[model samples]
Target: MKVMRLPGLAFILLLQGCNISAPAPGPDFPTSEMADIVFYNGTVITMNEDYPEGQAIAIKGKKILGVGTSLQALATANRTTQLIDLKGKTIMPGIVDAHTHVFNDRDRFGLDLPGAQELLFKNGITSLGNLFCTEEFVAEMRAFEPLLKVKTSLFLTKTFPCGEIQDSWYHGYPATRTPGEVLRINGIKITADGGTCGGMAVSEEFIPGTTGLGDLWHTQDEINAMVLEADKAGYQVAIHAIGDRAIEQAQNAIAYALDGRPNVLRHRIEHNSAIRPDLIPRYSEFGIIPVIFGWKKICDFYPRSPFYEAADFPYRTLIDYDPDLPVAWHGDDPYRGPVNPFIELHSMVTRTEVSETGALCTPPSWLAAQTIPVQTALKLMTLNAAYSLFRDDETGSLQTGKYADLIVLSANPLTIDPQDIHGIEVQLTMANGEIVYRLPASGL
Candidate 1:
C-alpha cells in the first residue's frame, strides 16, 4: 500500500497496551484508618425482630458492626470508610441453599459453569451446603478456598467403592484411610433405590437387585456397624431415602444408632418423598430432621407417577405431626429442579402444579396452610442448613462476630406476591465482607 509507516504501526501496538488519557481515580480512603462499608436507603430484613426493615447497615472485616437507621450507622463511618446507597432496594441476609450438589457436580465434571453459579447467586443464594462430595474434592476445594465465597461443608457418602463390605473396599474409598477417619467424617449418603426406573410406587422390584427384599446398599449388620461407628465419631448420618421401604430402613438405622444416646446429633433423611403416615411421628421422636422437597410434589412427582394423585402430598400431615421437629424445604437441584429457593417457596405456598406438558395446575386448597412462613423458610436455608452441618455457631444468621455472608435483593420478599419472589435479583453478594458478585445496572 502507500508506504505504511513502521513507526505508526509500533505506536498503535503501544497504544493498545496503555490508555493515553486515563480517568482520575475515585476518592481514596487511608489504609491505616478503620474501614467500614455501609449500605443505606434500603429495606433491610434483619431476620431478627430487634431490627426489622432498617435504613442502613455497617459491616467491617467479615462481621456486621452495626445495623440501625441511616444516621445511626453513619456515626461509625469515617472518610476512610466506603459508602453505598441502595436507592431503596431490598436487602437481606444472603440466601442459603440448604441442600445442593455444587461441589459434587464440579468434581464429577471438571468444568466451571458460571451460568450455574450465577443462577444461584443472581436469584439470592449466597451460601450452600454441599450435601455430598468426595474427600479428594473437599481437599482440593480447601486449597482454592478464597474464590469460592460460599460456605461449604463436606459430607462423605458411603458408596460401593469407598466402603468395605466383607473385607472388600469400594473403588472410591481411599485404601490408605483408616476406618476411624472415614467414620469421623460427616454423613454417609447412600442411594436406596433408582428413581423413575424403579416403579412410581415402592415394590419388591424397586429394591437393589432383582431379588427384591434385602438391604439396598449393605447388609443390616454392616449398616448398623457403619452407623454406630459414625455416631461414635460425632458424625450425623444423612441418608437419601425417597421410597417408603427406604424411609423405614433409614428410620430403623437412626433408632439403632441412637439407642442410648439421647439428643444425639439430629439424623437427617434426605428427600423423605414417600412416607407411610404412621412413620410421621418417628421423625420427631428420634430427633430426625426430614428435609422435604417442595418442588417434588408440585413439579417432579406429580408428573412422573400416579402417587401424587393417590395421596395428598401429606404436607399438612407432616407439619401437623411435628411442628418443632425442624422440617425444612429444599430443592435437590440441577438434578430435577432450579436452585432458586423462591421458586421452591412459591410452589410450596401455592401447591401449583407445573407439568412437563407446560400445563399449570393448582391444588384444591392453598397449600399455604402447610407451608412455613417466608421468615421460617429463610431460617431453613440459613440457620437450619448450618445446623445440619453442625456449624450453627459459626454462621447461619447475620450477627456480630460471624462471617459477613449476605446478599442484597432487589425487592422485599414479604410484601411482594410469592410468585414474583423468584423474580427478585441479587444486587450484590458479599462473603467475608468481600464483594463477590455485583449485578450490572441492566440487571443481566
Candidate 2:
C-alpha cells in the first residue's frame, strides 16, 4: 500500500503541538481560507490589557483568530465559516481551579466524573488542577481524558504524608514521567502542617481545639533539599501551609532553593490560611503563589476565632500589600470544601455562605470589610488560576492567538450584586473554539 500525504488538519495539529485526534481541514488548507468560526454581536470581555472589550471574536480550529468589533471580526470570515450571533450575551475566558483533590477511581470517594463534568461546565470551570495526584493517578486520568469534558492540570507529588522522598518516588506512587501542555506536572504538593479550625495552624495564638503549634513535617533544610531536588527535575514545589510558622518554614526552604538561581518555575502555598500580617510580604518577595480555597465560607474549619482576623485567609491584606501578588482560587472538593466555582467566587467577595438547602446566603454585617472587589474575585477563578498552573498564556483570557477557551454567562457578575453572582449560569461553554457544552434551549 502507498503512504498517503498528511492532510492540512494533521499538519496543523503537528504545528500546534496538540496530540489529540482531529478531523482533517478542507482541501484549501491554511492560508487560502479565513477563520473556521466567527462569533459576533456579544458583550465580550476580551480580558486582554490592550483590548479589554469586544463585540465579536473569530477562531481557526483550536486557536483564537482575533477579537474586535462585530464588523472587524466578521470581515475575516467567509460564507463557509460558521457565524454565531451572541445576541448581547456576556462572554469571558473559561474558569480555572488552581487547587483541588480527586481520586483515580471515579467510583471511589463517590467521585462522579460525568456529574462533575456537567457541574463544572454549567458553572464555567473549563480547566482545573488536581493538586492531589501521583504519576500513576495522572496517567490513568490522562488516558481517560477523552471521555471527559473539562481540561486537567495535574500536580505530581514526590513526598506525601509530609515526609522525605525515598526510592525516587513516594511510597505508593508510580514511575516518573514527563507531562504535556494540559496535563501539567506542577511540582510536588507537600503538607507542611494541618488545618486552621482544628487549632493546628502552627500559630502562637491558642485555641480550644488543640495546641496551636501545628505539625511541621519537614524542617527548612529538609524542605530546601526537596525543593532543590524537585527544581533539578524540572518541577516547582507547592507546600501546604496554614499557620504563620508553617508558612515561614516553607518560605525559608524555597528561599534557600532559589539561592543562586532565578526562580523561573513557580512555587506555591496551598490553603495558605491563618498567615500572619507580617509574613504576607515574603510570599511576593519569594514569588510564592498562594492557591487559596475561597469556599471556606462553607466550612467551620475556620470558624470564629479571636485569632482569625489578621490570620485566616487574609486575602484583603495580601492584595493590599501587593496588588501584583498573584493569587488563585480553588474548590478543594471531597476534601473539606465545595467544588462549585460560583460558591467560591461569591464566598471570596462576600465572605458568606448559602443555607443547607441552598439559597438564603447572608453576609455577616460585622465581617463586611473582608470582601474583595468583583473583578479581583473573577481573576481568582480565571487568569490567576491558570497562571498558577502555568497555562495562563494558553487559556486564562480572551486574547488573540490564544486557545478559544471561553464561556457565555447569563449575566455579567462584575456589574451585579456579589451575593447574586453564584446564581449565574453558563449559557454555553466552548473549549479550543469548539462548543463542548450548551443549554438545550440554546439550539446549538
Q: Which candidate should be chosen as best, given lDDT against the real structure?
A: 2
- Candidate 1 deviation (Cα RMSD): 12.1
- When summed lDDT is taken over every stretch of 10 residues in candidate 2, the lowest stretch is 20-29
Which residue pairs come into collision in candidate 2? 202-214
Candidate 2 residue-wise lDDT, 158-250, digit = tens: 556545453446323322333224454556677676662233455665454645465677677777787777767767678877777878888
Per-residue CA lDDT of model 1 for 121-229, tens digit only, reads 6666666656655566556665656355565545566643223333212223422212112112345555543342332224333224443433355456666676676
RMSD of each: 12.1, 8.5
Indicate which candidate wins on TM-score.
2
lDDT by candidate, in order shown: 0.59, 0.69
